[model samples]
Target: MSKKSPERTPPESLHLPRVGVETHAHLDSREFRDDLPQVLDRAAASGIAAMGQVFLGPEAYQANQALFDSHPEVFFLLGVHPTDADKFTDATLAAMDAAFASDARIKAMGEIGLDSYWKDVPPETQHRIFRAQLALARERDLRVVVHSRDAFAETLAVLDDMGFKDRPLLWHCFGGDEAIARELLSRGWLLSIPGPVTYSKNVELARAVAAVDMDRLVVETDCPYLTPEPWRGKRNEPALAVFTAARIAQLKGLSVEDAWRHMGQTAAKFFGLELPK
Candidate 1:
């Protein structure tokens, strides 16, 4: 009979300092409806100092912004996802604009780029909505968070056309190779590394993490999704970002704590949040 493998260490047992930032998460999703308080506790105990809670649209934002009322560590990213291009409208933009104007925690205009991975939305419609959001971000002078999937080329073209070069933009959920990393870095954009980097088969992402400047790299769980290795089959949470940081540390030849702290600091600066103490 084959021997059973040993159990992996729990994320809290990693003993990472509370200097990690989870740069992306859909905490508002119904998956956490039953036990969000516990999830937030786990995230805190696992050393996550702050987290970026992404609201997919104006409705989600308005409805769920109160969920984190007691958890000041959670910031916000508001955007109309490309797959929801059909729902993008003037009213949506107006809601987002009003939210940004009134709320200090809403830090960036993002997770807002082209996603051709699913063909439900037409490419033209996605492009049009993407441009509109980009223009809005520029108008508000807010940092932008981008979500590009199988539409990297088109997304880059749109960003370039809109003169986003050297603007404060972050490429969210970056699973690209070193060459792709270089292209974004060249435009002075930051890359938000995600849980998939911990997958053993993701060699290209490993190479990119190793080659990129550490200052330009940030970590995210994208959770309740993209759960990292050792927990790949489970629902991802902000606490699991420690594993993502651990893998990034291994690729970059740095201590996991250092990687965690640095990425946290980078994200804090990028999102205009106070650095973790």
Candidate 2:
């Protein structure tokens, strides 16, 4: 689904009786520009203690770097998104290498993987770019956030081609079946669930979420995109992650606190991220 801005303001901050850590969000998106402070506050007010952001371009990345400096509670995953694969170049990769070298807040080189579904960029070019970034992530010993669409099998082959030993590889906005989830689990990869699981028509995706081992599960909003239910049509934000966490709780038969604790710890361990001091 294409990303869009939500029209409603933050719902009254619900006390979720849990610590919701948003594993993925696009705080850098233009959607949040006008009311960025309100968005961040609403997230905090709504019980989202921490959030991980995916940086798509220089403009967004630069803005996020500034946000990180100003808000230590916010962390990031930096990389050229698959849609922007055409922009990948030797110089850009070099600059990214430097950023990875210097920045400790960059938790992963991410939101990077194959996207045959869109196919905006040529397959060959995308492969080259994906492999290059994978190499960089491996070299830096950083976690890799993958965004695979209808290209899961092909993505798996590419990942396998690399010496991708048990590194922290997260499949963000996971929209796969149980079989796919099993394969990812077998590879010792983690899956980040998004707001769509709350939708009624997504039984297969819901089953996948239920099938995911607690240790391998993390929650995401993919904000400015998949806003959770009760507010499905509204624009997504970090605060709404609580609903996703709550849904996981319902599916797992655990309390929201338990789900958040497990998912939060799993994400923190995988990304080597820490709660803000």
**Leading candidate by TM-score:** 1
lDDT of each: 0.93, 0.82
Expressed as tens digits, the lDDT of each residue in 126-216 for candidate 1 is: 9999999998999999899999999889999999999999999999999999999999999999999988998989999999999999999
Candidate 1 residue pairs in clash (backbone atoms < 3 Å)? none
Model 2: lDDT of residue 43 = 79
Compared with the true structure, what per-residue lDDT tens digits does model 2 show for residues 57-117?
Answer: 5446765678557776788788887788998889878888888888788788888888888
Q: Each candidate's TM vs. the true structure?
A: 0.97, 0.92
Model 1 alpha-carbon drift over 4 Å, by segment: 1-6
Model 2 clashing residue pairs (backbone): 6-235
